[model samples]
Target chain A: MYLVEKLGEKTIELFHSIFEIVQFLLLIFLHLVNPKSYNPAMRMVLTKQIYFTAIGIIPIFILMAIIFGSVVIGVVIYLSTAYSLESEIGSIIITFVVDEFAPFFTALLISLRSGAAINTEIAVMSVNKELNTLKEYKIDIIDYLFLPRIISGIISVTSLSFLFALIMLGSGYLFTFFYMDMDFNTYKYLLLNAIELRDILTLIFKSFAFGFVIMLIPIYSGLKTQNHYTAIPVSVLNGMVRLFVAVFFIEVLSLIIQFF
Target chain B: MCENIALIKAVHENMSISEANTLAVEMLSMIGLQKIAYKRVENCSKDELLLVMFIRALMTKEKSVILKLPSEIIGGLFHIENILKDMRKVNTSKEIFVCDLVSSKAYYKECECHIEESN
Candidate 1:
């Protein structure tokens, strides 16, 4: 009987989570459909979000991408050479680096950094009655708060993922030059030739979806926080965990679709 | 049927950039807070913030406005009275709902009803 009750509770929690996500997405859709939603104040907020999430992290993101890309390229080259399958280097790099690692790493970085911050900030606002204060002022929270963050998340993630792919691919070429007797032009040719239109489109779609989940999960968790101070940390933890799970889920789904 | 209705809380209000600036200056001067009118809200004292919010709510030409007084400022009946007086000057016909922890019947002569929360 206890086991059945726990299962039922879990099922209900899952349904609630889905409902919250759908509700948030609906709000974003409504904002897009309404021209009145756009204002200078919201534009300022969106620009700030993009700056903090994408532009601010560029230095660290580039460093991490370089290290990871070099390591992956080194391993791929060593393995391919040992097995005498050197010709397939471009295909392997395209499949692994461009299609998978770029979006996954970008999502992970964003979720860990910006997602946690957004979650904690929103949670604090909710707990402090700031959100209630906004309501009292007859301000639309959706137009002022949610829409800007949502648009920022989508734009930042897509742009950052593209930048990550470009930097990593360049790093791979530099590693090839240092570790092996390969020309930069040859490596560039191989990578560019292997990348197809479908791969680019898939990468874009995955980044967009991952971005949506990153912002949505954090915002949802933050909104769940009540007036209690204890709820803030709990909301942040829940948001981060859910964001990572959603990222991996999307990545796996994309891979399956591409292969099958 | 004013195009904008505002509930005054903290320092946030719904107004165009130009209107907000103009109103903020005018209301600050009216409330004897002209010196700190342009300062960031985060730097303002609780009383100052409350005064700003009161003025913001009053500036709205809307038919109905809601003003939520933070619990900290409820004891300041003098400030509340001045706010109501200033509001009367702006739009005598506009209906105002002042929600606070304390009953403000003594300070506001125009208030028609008092609604208390039952614990």
Candidate 2:
């Protein structure tokens, strides 16, 4: 029984990878061709994703960022005051908010919002032959469904992350100013020239790629649906798994590219 | 039948009608171009499939193939020429284990026209 379960799991994983490859390529094709096949469906998907993902996360993200920021500031001040690194307070806040936390949080929030939702929706759509029917109707599926989501996901993720990062930075700075009483100008001096153009570019690139991959993997898996309704949940489940895997791999790759 | 012969003759020099359509559809599928539809697979002459495939390929790649389509008997011959260029790159990528599927003969002659048009 143990050996049989292992074999079954391995086979499923293998097939999942195969289907994902095919689906991603197909979507890429649809993307490049700018299919006008399904405008209404595309718009609907976009509207729904925006409302569910971008709308639902704002308050929660802000609150989480505040708590994380305050705690980090408390630690920074405690250590920096003792070590004579008080002047580096601003740099610490900026790095924590921008470099490490912002992107990861943005990706996480967006993943929860768009990744899970799109994967399930597409998987369901696929099992129903909805995608195939659109094709049969000669409606351009790319232009309608996928592209809109891509655009919306990028915008939504970017906007929300920027908001959360700002809140965290502000909260951290407030702690530094009030409790630590670090000189504000010294803190500014620490960070103003510290940010390189490359770092900014890396941040944008990382966020964009995160948004892209999150949407890409799930939708790709969803489109591979065979005509069985069970396949819907199964594909979505597989997509969720792949989405996390891609996110992890991309994060590592981005760090390597940015630093090395 | 003379009509079938005429249709086949009209298709082009080498590929039969069915071969070209299947080849065109298969090639499109191979390249991950799902949105590019194959409407009315039959009744296209080789020349027509040649024109259609060329147009479709160019469009799929987001190249401007519209003006070139009416330029010659082969219409957008530039489309096929570009495919040939990509095919040459495939040879180089093959050594690195990357599959260069786009550089195939689907662009060499519009078999789509020959097959589908003939059908």
Off by over 4 Å in 1: A1-6, B1-42, B59-61, B64-71, B74-119
Q: What is the per-residue lDDT of model 2 for residues A54-157, given as tens digits with 9 covering 90 to 100? A: 78877888888789877876786778778887666556656666766777788987887779888888887677666774564344556656776776777776
Instruction: Give one digit per residue, the lDDT tens place, for model 2 in B1-119.
Output: 11121222122323444454454554444433323434443544444444344433332323232222222434444465444333233212121111112333245364222211211
Q: In model 2 chain A, which range of ten residues has the least summed lDDT?
A: A35-44
Each candidate's B-chain TM-score, in sequence, is 0.50, 0.26
TM-score of 2: 0.57
Return the top candidate by lDDT: 1
- For model 2, the stretches where C-alpha displacement exceeds 4 angstroms are A1-48, A76-84, A183-190, B1-119
Candidate 1 lDDT over B1-119, as tens digits, reads 01121222112443455565555566566556777766766667766666666566665556776766644554466556555555554423667677765464555554435555644
Q: Tens digit of lDDT per residue, candidate 1, span A52-159?
A: 989999999999988987888788888887898789888888878778888888999999998999999899989988788678666678877787888888898999
